[model samples]
Target: MASSAASVLNRLLQNASRPKKPSQPPPSPSLILHHINSNNFAAAFSALFSIPTPLSIPLYSRLLRISASTRSLVDARHLESHIISTHHPRHPPTFLLNRTIETYAACGSLRDARELFDEMPRRNGGTWNAIISAYASAGHSHDAILLFSRMNKSGSSRPNDVSFACALGSCADLLALLLARQIHCLVLKYGFAKNVILSTSVVDVYGKCGIMSDARKVFDEMRERNAVSWNVIVRRYLEMNEGEEAVILFFTMIVDGVRPLNFTVSNALVACSDVSALKEGCQIHGIAVKLGFDGDHVVENSLMEMYAKNGLLEDARKLFDDSTSRDVVSWTSIISGYALCGRFAEAEKLFDSMPERNVVSWNAMLAGYVRCLCWGKALDFIFLMAKESEEMDNVSLKLILNVCAGVSDLELGKQVHGFVFRHGFCSNIFIGNALVDMYGKCGNLRSAELWFLSMASNRDKISWNALISGYTRHGRSEEALNAFGEMQWETTPNEFTCSTALAACANIFVLRHGKQIHAHMIRNDFNMDVIIQGALVDMYCKCRSIEYAINVFEQATSKDIILWNSMIMGCAYNGRGEFGLELFEMMLKDGTKADNVTFIAILLACITEGYVDLGHRYFNLMSDEFGIIPRVEHYECMIELLGKHGFMVELEDFIERMPFEPTTPMWMRIFDCCREHSYARLGERAERWINESNPLNPVEFNVCSGPAMEPS
Candidate 1:
């Protein structure tokens, strides 16, 4: 069969090069058309070229239709060349010439179509639409838009619905919202706004541009809509991460009794997955089954992803096991589920056993390792993936950068940055943000700032967040605040920006900056979420504004454990232990569950207030009631509590009974307490421990446990 195909192709090439006289008189146009209708285009083309008579424009136009239907570039080229050679058209040949252009475009030779279009003696509306549609269909969006604008300026012809639809499609591709609006007004001016096809195109462009308000307005005003219209709006919402809106539209479509398409079900499922709305996802699944689309490949894949992302992994795994139509997407969906759940061992086994792997599948396993925080393993697997040369996409690159940030692997991050540049991914805003985050996290703020500045035009909120968070992480609080200020010039800061900026303010005691950010949030209605409330409390407390901290803490309509913990710790730091203890008791009475962090704050209060007995009781409650393990910080607080009260024997005994070796900070805390109480014996032990633990202990010191004062 291979050899036979080779022989046939050789003959076709030979025929293309040499024109032999038809051994018989040129077949009648009817007979030649019979060959074309039978799809014997080669024979039909040869006979048409051999015709001895000049053809009518109608006959030539009919022949161009057949060639367009064939979608054969070679046949289209031959037909055009033969027509050019015959020079058969008399005057105003635009009708037949327009079809030749359409035929050339349909055959995927826009270059040839364009040249012919430009050479036309005179072009009509049909001629302009044909070329515009050709450019639109070929994905030459900019050129299509340019030509569409030219058509209006040249006044060569008035554009009908078809021409507007083509130009609107180009605007959709480029996300040219302003241009789309202009075309939309023209659509109204030309009295084509009611045409369903043209109306649908306007809706599609508005949706793709992410102007949902306009999209909905147009849709509501539509005298009619098809399934394509419904699908476009829902899909655009999902793409823009407006999942709730997508789901609302999906339900609206159903209530309108528009029979759900397979893709409609798929889009609804995607919305459900994104928002983790499991109930809605299951509803869509049932809809698919009811519509007999349950067996559809796309719906089944969407179901798998939906179930996995919503934490129904067992259901997803069961579906994967029962599915007979497993493709790369099916496998990847299941693997990503396992990764999301932090079950890397199972994810890896399934990934290795899959019959085929694409970049998505590879990224799934790599992401699993990163999500599980197995950084070293993730680093190793990425290197393994490099061996396969799986074309790393932005998702994979971001995951790898995340691993670099996780382990603070600057060298590896630089290598991946090179890979991003080599593959022309640096211009992608998401990847650029990831690069900034990676460099910032690796403690290289200069590189992060440089990258941020370089992408000045494209940077979004996430980009500014990355640089601000990086500065805060490395103790460059002033820089972090400055970046936040500058960010206001380009883009408004969101919760993440405010959170980090507040932290920087807290670090440097910049109460003025913290207050300004708070006012800005109020003005923007940034909706003082729980995280913001917590940061506000910590910031005020750190800046020695206890009254303001208390005011914000009490005014919060709802308080989570983190907010309670922050207020309590702030009180302890500012010598307000009594008030902090009162807040803790109120927290318990409020039925807020205290975790390990809450216990840490309470213990700090105990240490500051010198409540020796209360500190011991809370330490016991950590294990007895809350099942919280007593971490080293809790133990250090206990030592300080005992030493400050001059319970020297108990402090010594407590240190001896500790479950683990004390850290340097613990020894230093014990040393400070013992020096204040003039307890020499314990002070000596702490000095030796500090020296052994951190050989570089640099503070000039002696047993400032000061000479032992005789007991009373």
Candidate 2:
């Protein structure tokens, strides 16, 4: 009895010391829903996994919806796995599974979305729409269209309004007009045309495809128009260069009581800028201010650009200064404004003062300098851009390469080429063209050709033009003509291509090639442009076909200053100086003002005719009357005219009173005239000037001195 009692006590003690199982809490669906509703997804996710009971289909569906709506793809995926693992060969509820698929699609995990979509034993319209929209949104338009067709053929689920919208969007993206038209017909057949969103999509697609009429027709047919509808058509008109139409539409929108959105105002302003309708632009600006959109960055930037384009720099500056918040675009606008107005120093100063600088700002500054012909300053900015660790994009590199070409800085261009290679921008077609052009301009034809050949598959007309122009510029006319011939088989020659090729023909005096190119131009209808006409005139003159040049000139219905100058120079080159002078008078009478080139041409004509008085009158008239500064070439022409007339005393006095010292070549011209007229004393003075100009070239100086040393 005693041992039994001891064993019972020991058993009781052991039982007392042992741990008891704690009561498990029930799953709180309300708590999970609350956390999810409050966007405390982490807490909800944690609460979900802690549930002791098996998750109901409703609960799982709710969680998946929350995940899908919040884009909690990770949690949605996790819950999906749990449902699959727990069900184990028994399918989860269709709603829960579909929500999971939608979540994946929304997260850009189309791969997972597709796998889940295919794995479902049963599918619904929502599931198909989810996957198709995902594909379309990811820029896989072809795949989206293919899947839509497959969905149609399946006949399992009829596509709804959302599906049609997604499919139409895909068609629009692909710019597949035929497919889009079929889809439009489908929309009509399915009676989805009444859906405003679908109708808007149709209009947008047509507009983007450059079918403005079709876009307008679709837009007009909309039973009820929204701001989006108006914006689309207005923007399309601006893009199609129909600025007046865009402005009219904006006024119509206001009359119809549709409030213009920011985009509408911005686009309307862009149209105004395009047409240089300053009054219309200012009206829009006032409307934007009244609408309280002037404070908006995008609208303000557009307004600034419009003002600048209209030459209202002060107004643009005022707008820029008044803005409370400024972005890179704002800075770029103001900089470009100053640049367009030729205030490069101010532009640079503004660029330096910017709180932040981006590639666009840098590019704007570079372009501004280039426009002002500040090549050295542009190059300096490029170097500074490099030092700042800013990755030079294709535009930056292209701009710098152009500056290098402008200044003929080959070493800097080579360095930029190295930068291009290092950054792997060589494969870009524009950069490739720029590189080829730069090399050609720098007198590195071999490298230019190599770069041109390297861009074999990427070569466009621009590439061909750059190469051909480079060759022509460097006097490699044969290569230029050969390149032009090759270009004919590769691509149709543009106006620039034909113009540059004609220039090559002119340089070599190849009338046959010129005629052939001219025939090509006529065949292709490329000769109507004034630029090409000017080229043809110059070409014929160089080929000694003065009559052909004159015929071409007479046929030009409207002649710009360049065309006028080309004709005048052609007459001068062909020794018809008097005719050239007569043409100049005709040019003046035609209301075409004479620029510096015109003056040069007329002066050359005077020199050709040995009209000393006429040359003198025109030279003074150029600066005094027309306000045209006389460049070195003009001075050179004056010297040549005086020397040719054997006016030694006058020539010497003119040289001594000139604003600039006479160059070696000018003195050489004088020396040649002295020899021709037997003016030994003046010839000795001209010899001394030439020798003093080239102190390093003693041998040439001795040779030049021999003539003056001769006793005449």
Candidate 3:
């Protein structure tokens, strides 16, 4: 039977040997339905192609769904061809064409989707949303935003809530506050103000764009709220590092009787992690357990992160080990947790044992190594990651740039710079800033300036800080001050830049400029965090302005140990040893703990006061009382104190009882001290040791009262 049918069909296909006056039969819709019912969309499409008949709108919509599900560009194109045959070439049904555009986008051929959309003679809100969502989801935020603008101006389509939501999302992604506000106005003008989803999107955009007050206003105005709205507002606070606000909102959500979902619990945990709120995290964990989200993978991972970030590594490890549904995120979180606490060996072990890894996982490990300053291993891991074709994003590049700066690997930094340009990440200002920082720290000031200038209008406070810090770090204090001057003209000085400026002033002893910066900070209401306060004290002290330094220290509302140390050391160095001692007593009374640097200052004070007995007691107190087990610097200060007081036997005994062999600098310091005291015998012995330690650069002191110079 098959052979007979084939032979007859073959005779009919041989160019019709006999002409017949027969009519072409109508196409069978049942055949198309049969193929469709059997779930063979490709075959159904083929049958439709053969018949070339119009399909019902419902059937065409069904076909579009199938094409989109398959995500096959071929299926999309075939369906489009059938649509064109069924309708006018320039005008398919608007709804059908909208779905077609979406199908093309889902197939990842946005160009084809766009061409179809452009060729459409008419469009509706769905048409605009289809393309806008496609671009937004694919991370082309700029293009998506542009399309939304065109849609608004064309007036061909009255965009609905979805269109505004997608546009607002793109605005959030781009941080385009102005466009976000415009879209927000459109949402109101178009009467979508009551839409909860649209409202949440507005809040998200405002929060992400750093207009928190506006975000809060929109959020408060929402007459009705959903879990999504709460989550969006809370997560916005987390993004801004306002962990307290996020946690407060989470509690408010619970009090409002809105039970948190798994992601909600996860976000709350992240907030706790941000603030190191272990008790609150534990409370959330209890809530999760009661809500049955404790077993959820997302909540579990966040729990581990919370514990780890709060330095409860053992608790985190237990959760990691007990997790039953650990995904890649779970693994990455646990790995990052270990790495956060300087346990790289354990982190790498877990990372190696992971079942699957993504770029986040790789970057987390790299960040761990970078944090621990294991520069060589970080470079190796990133290189190996690249060799394995793992996609390196901007974070990885920044880490590599940091490593290059740390190791002064200028050649490698340049290569990474080239990679940045090639990979089209040059527009990322953070990466550009990293490049400048890398070049600056690597001693390539010229490259640093060039990169900074190339940034043009993109230069932010960090760029200026990096340039000025480089000059300050490498002892070009004058240039650093000059750069700071230039920065003041280009942009308002931030706290970091002001701090660097103060340091430059101190280095050059330009008390006038330091006073000006201090006044400017006061006038501008700059963020006078503890760090800036410390810098102010250090600058004033280093410039020999003990009175002014005291004024800054006394005026500071908040003071850390660093500030205390700076004040003490400044007083001691400026010949106010007794007052420096009083400050130390005050530091202790104020509940501030002293470190090794503090004791060094104390020893210096004792030396200035000629209290040899007190210096010995304090040196002993470093180990016996404070448990600071003195470092070589502390020991040197003690020996200098003893030698300056002509306590020869005690200084020699202190050097002999040292835990490690004396270094050239230690011996040189000893020789200078011995010469100061006219202790000739010990001076010659110290000279002998300096010569033995650094033979190439022989010591040339003549036992006279001349200033010491660098060995040559």
Candidate 2's C-alpha runs over 4 A off are 1-25, 34-43, 47-62, 82-92, 138-161, 164-226, 233-259, 290-292, 389-391, 488-490, 511-530, 547-560, 588-596, 620-632, 635-712
lDDT score for candidate 1 against the true structure: 0.88
Ranking the candidates on lDDT from highest down gives 1, 3, 2
Over 497-544, each residue of candidate 1 has an lDDT whose tens digit, in order, gives 999999999999999999999899888888787889999999999999
Taken over the whole model, the C-alpha lDDT of each candidate is 0.88, 0.86, 0.87
Model 3 CA deviation exceeding 4 Å by range = 1-31, 49-54, 72-92, 111-147, 375-391, 411-415, 418-425, 489-492, 523-527, 555-559, 589-593, 627-712
Per-residue lDDT tens digits for candidate 3, residues 204-308, read: 999999889999999999999999999999988998889989999999999999988778789989999999899999999998999898788888999999999
Candidate number achieving the greatest TM-score relative to the actual structure: 1
Model 2, 299-329: lDDT tens digits are 9999998998788999999999989888888
Could you tell me every candidate's TM-score relative to the true structure?
A: 0.90, 0.81, 0.83
Q: Give the TM-score of candidate 2.
A: 0.81
Candidate 1, residue 216: Cα displacement in angstroms equals 2.7
Q: How many clashes (backbone N, Cα, C below 3 Å) per candidate?
A: 0, 0, 0
| Cα displacement (Å) at residue 78, model 3 | 5.1
lDDT of 3: 0.87
TM-score of 1: 0.90
lDDT of 3 at 310: 95
Better of 1 and 3 by TM-score: 1
